[model samples]
Target: MIEVVSLIDAAPPRVFDLELDMDVHAGSLPGSQETATTSTGRRQLALGDEVTFHARHLGLNWQMTSRISAYEPPYHFVDEQVRGPFRALRHEHHFEDLGDGGTRMTDRMSIHAPLGPLGAMVTRLLLAPYLSRLLRQRAIHIKRLAENVDRRR
Candidate 1:
């Protein structure tokens, strides 16, 4: 189980707006590259939307497809693995209105390793710490972008 919580200095709608644009959100993350909409357009990120991602992590290339299982405007969204390296992967994202022009965002995820006991051992020894740092860095980047960078046109 992996959980992370972050507060952004923007309203729920603003934070949600950033998330709704999959391409932009994905590009903002460090080491993430070459994001594009699949043959599936408009249906790209709504509930039931299926998106494919190709990324490199730890010097290894990874390709995976994720489906949006839950979506509620300005509130929450969830994506689960339709196909990925993990035996199981589920990520939930939540947004709460902070009233003072801010949004509190939370991410909860559970990932089951692939190689049974060996996978669990590797996760406990290496993967967890690395993933935690990556997630925290992403949160910090989002906060800076949401609070200081204005994307409204």
Candidate 2:
């Protein structure tokens, strides 16, 4: 499991809404060429929503489908992969009000590599760190979006 915590300079509800916007994630990460290919067209994702994505990782193209199995509005949400390269993948998002117009966000990811020991070794030596950086970058991107969301309001 890889966990990331971020203090976003935005209200909890604002950050939560931005976090659920799929469009914000498009092209947010470097070199992934990420795109939601199926089960989408909605403005924001909710419980039971599934999105299939295609991206390039580790020099290979991959496709994964994830379902929002759990959602609790401006508090928390969980997305689990139904089909993907990994043996298992679950991402949980948690947000709490900071009492100062900001939000404390926690992102927890549980991932399992295929091929057992070899995959585990590779994950520990390479994949985990890479993913950690990727998630942190993603968080920064979302935080910026959330903080600036109401600029036109």
Candidate 3:
């Protein structure tokens, strides 16, 4: 399993609001370039809602569909892999109100490599560290966006 965590300064509601907007949130990722190929039907995300991600990872084109397994407004949301390269993936998005008009946002993800031990070995040797750096960069970008965007408040 591989894990990454980040804290963002923003109100919980604001953070949740931004996260529910899949397109907007995906666009904020550092190395991710995502476009909505299919409509989710509703404007706001809810449990069971399906979102598609067309992304370029490590210069490879990839398509993934994620299903919302849990959703709690102003608190957290969880998305599970419906289809992707990973054998298993569970991503949790959480927000804690700092009480001073700021929120602490966290993202925790656990992934199992698709190729079993061999994949795990490869990830440990190559992907894990790179992914950590990527996630950190993404966190910084998110923090800057949330702080600078007028609508975030």
Candidate 4:
């Protein structure tokens, strides 16, 4: 499991709404060349929505389909992989109101690689750290956007 936490200088509703925006998600991982399309072809994801992402990662092109298994507006959501490189992957997003008009965002991912011992080794040594960094980078991107930083100069 990989966990990442970020504090954003914005209300929970704003942070949560941005997190559910597909365009923000793609923009956050510019280096990965990630693009996503939802089952409903909507820009925002809601309960039971599925999203398919195509990207280049770790020198390989990959595709993953994940469904929003659980969702509670402005508070929590879970996306579970339906098909992907991993044997299993479930990501949980949590937003907490700090009562100072700021939000605390937490991301927890449970990933299981395919195969047996070899897969376990690979996940521990490589996938875990790589994914952790990826999540952290995403958090930073979201934080900037939530704080109203206009980077398009």
The prediction achieving the highest lDDT against the true structure is 4
lDDT scores of the candidates, listed in order: 0.77, 0.87, 0.73, 0.95
Which ten contiguous residues of candidate 4 have the minimum total lDDT? 144-153
lDDT of 2 by residue, 90-141 (tens): 9999999989888999999988999999999988898888889888998999
Measured against the true structure, the TM-scores of the candidates, in listed sequence, are 0.87, 0.93, 0.83, 0.96
Ranking by lDDT: 4, 2, 1, 3
Give a tens-digit lDDT track for model 1, residues 1-153.
788899898888777767656665576665756364543675236788788767777778777788888999889999888887878778888999988888998888777779989999988888777677767776776777688865484
Q: What lDDT score is found at residue 60 in candidate 3?
A: 88
Candidate 4: misplaced stretches above 4 Å?
Answer: 149-153
Top model number, TM-score: 4
What lDDT tens digits, residue by residue, belong to model 4 across residues 31-133?
A: 9999999999899999999999999999999999999999999999999999999999999999999999899999999899999899999999999999999
Q: What is the lDDT of residue 148 in candidate 2?
A: 72
Indicate the worst ten consecutive residues by lDDT in candidate 1: 35-44
Stretches of model 1 off by over 4 angstroms after superposition = 34-36, 42-44, 149-153
Q: What is the alpha-carbon lDDT for the whole of candidate 2? A: 0.87
The parts of candidate 2 lying over 4 Å away from their true place are: 38-40, 151-153
Superior candidate under lDDT, 1 versus 3: 1
| Candidate 4 lDDT | 0.95
